[model samples]
Target: MLRNIVEEHFDNDPDVTIAAAKQIRRMDRDYADVGDKLYALQIAKGNRLLDEDDLDGSWGQFDEAGALKPDAPEAPNGKRQVLLAKGWKEMERCYHACPDLAIDALEQIMQIDANFREARSKLYALYVSKADRLGRACDRDGAFPHLMRALEIYPEGGEAQQGLAVCTPTPIPTPPPAAPVQVPTVTPRVVLPTPPPPPPNSPTDISAAPNSPTDPPVVRANASSAAHPAEKSARTGCARAEQSARTGCPVTEDSWRTKLITLAA
Candidate 1:
């Protein structure tokens, strides 16, 4: 009954196991192993709690087991397992929401056991993830340390190498001076010759006077003298007028009247 209680009730009813062990020890000397059985029960309960991810409960069980038998290796080993499980749980829960907390938790796990279940890899991945997130947010300065730490963890990590490359500053090259602009030459304009003025007293230069008694006589050109005797007489009158104008002499009225009457006849 005591063996059954220790084996079955240790996980579900720890108080029942304790009561059974106490009663069995008082009743028979053959059951002198009750104290050792109780120690085993506590260690078993702690391991079960650890497997169920009940960190606080597992820690309490491991502490009670160690108090029961301080020289036992199982209790100390169980306590270490519980701490490792706690660190893993914290890291998983806060990796994205609170990366610093997650890093601290993983680091604690490293202190507990550097070889604990891929803790180094998990820590490296966390740093890389944090660096990537900050880089995406344009916080390169904030991301630098995390990227550097990730590279330290894994010197040959491709993602860490790429991230560091992105963070480094590159110098800009200076541009060459621009070529001078060319100005086009203009052509001179050609000058044309001016035409000569028409000659004075040309046949087209004739002008007529107004028909008035006080007005001077008008001379008209003869198209042809052979056209008629009248035309020949008219030409003679025009010749006499031109002769009077050249000498700057006034013609006698009687002479002009006689010449005009003859041309008219």
Candidate 2:
């Protein structure tokens, strides 16, 4: 009846089954299989708690199961299932509110099971999202590490590739010079010839000579004889007339009168 009670409480009440098994072990020293029965009951209780999402309670039950039978595979497997469930729950709760914590949770899941329920994809997306936010806030230096990590997670991710390109730095360039100016030349002047002066005055120029006060007043003899020629002729005729009268060789009175008239003429 006690063994049947232990078997009946194994699924529904593991604690009752544990108490019944302990009482059976105490009553009959031949009941050596109670230890194995106790281990099974504890593993059953841990699976029940894991299904209820009671990670702490499940961990305690599995720990006790492991202590009962250290070489048991059931306890370790149950603990692993609990850790996976806990990590997934934490990541879902804090992914938007606290992304860093969510990222840590996903990374832990990766260590346990790399392909655990989109963990690698979620981690890659988180890194890319952090990098994008930092880049938009003008913190490219801070964004580089996250972008690099994202690329490491997903080498072929277009978003991560584009982000890395945006975060990288480049160089600048220079300019050219200007040209020169021009000037003109000047010309020379010309010269002319000079003319000659006039000649000097001669001694024949009467206007150049002045009169002397002591010069004698000269008279012309031809001018004086020409002016009295008729008077001298009349005087000569009178002398001839008087000499004829004195001579009186054949002096007729008529001849004497004729001679006088001729002298007068």
Candidate 3:
């Protein structure tokens, strides 16, 4: 208890008990420091358990003494020399049935010292096995945690890296849907055959007013008789064109010819 308290609580006194423990184990190989005579009683109890084929109980007592007496080179039971042996034995006995129970036994060995012989490697392998099983079952969420634990112990392990990738999800790219085909719609143009443009004299044809067939002859005659030809022709020809238009009769070609002869004279 004192050793556990000192190692667990005080940061400075952790190794303080090592020297004293060594001396006690050297003189009293049975561990006089443990409490009255707990070590002796454990040995008796271990012998009785062994007689009953209780290998587990016997191993526990042996291991407890090993912890109490680290430096007892010649101590009958010895210090963890068989550290991995007992866990391996237990794992073998129950591994085919309940792997976790066997794994727990190995983990207890790890608590004593993680690097103890093959315990770390064995524990890491078990984690990989569990990871593979869960991943194969499509339980990635369950698999990843075990893979992470394995990596923590052996960061560069190939099995752990492979298992992690197996458990990881991959995204599939979906192609965009195909574009729909467009059909051409033809609207027939209702070409009401251009209603042959109204005659140039028609009152509705504003576009034809400048070149009215009836106004052009009068315009040419008025232009010849006046000095400011464009201004005078515009005023006189437009007035005659308006009168001819209102009377619904075109100007006589003879009237235009007469105007032209007067201008010449």
| Among all candidates shown, the one with the greatest lDDT | 2
Error of 2 at 76 (Å): 1.7
**Model 2 over residues 146-208: C-alpha lDDT tens digits?**
988888878989999898888885545455555555556657666565655434664566554
**Model 1, span 1-265: residue lDDT tens:** 6778767876688778967875776687367577787777778778888888898998988897798689989989998998899889889899889989999999899889978888889898999998999999999999999999888877888899899889886768789898988879889899898987767754453344245797676666666844788877787678778979997876766877887899999
What TM-score should be assigned to candidate 1?
0.51
Lowest lDDT sum, 10 consecutive residues, model 1, at 202-211
Instruction: Name the regions of candidate 3 deviating beyond 4 angstroms.
Output: 1-85, 170-199, 202-265
lDDT of each: 0.83, 0.84, 0.66
Please give the distance, in angstroms, between residue 195's alpha carbon in candidate 3 and its true position after superposition: 16
lDDT of 1: 0.83
Looking at model 1, how many pairs of residues clash? 0
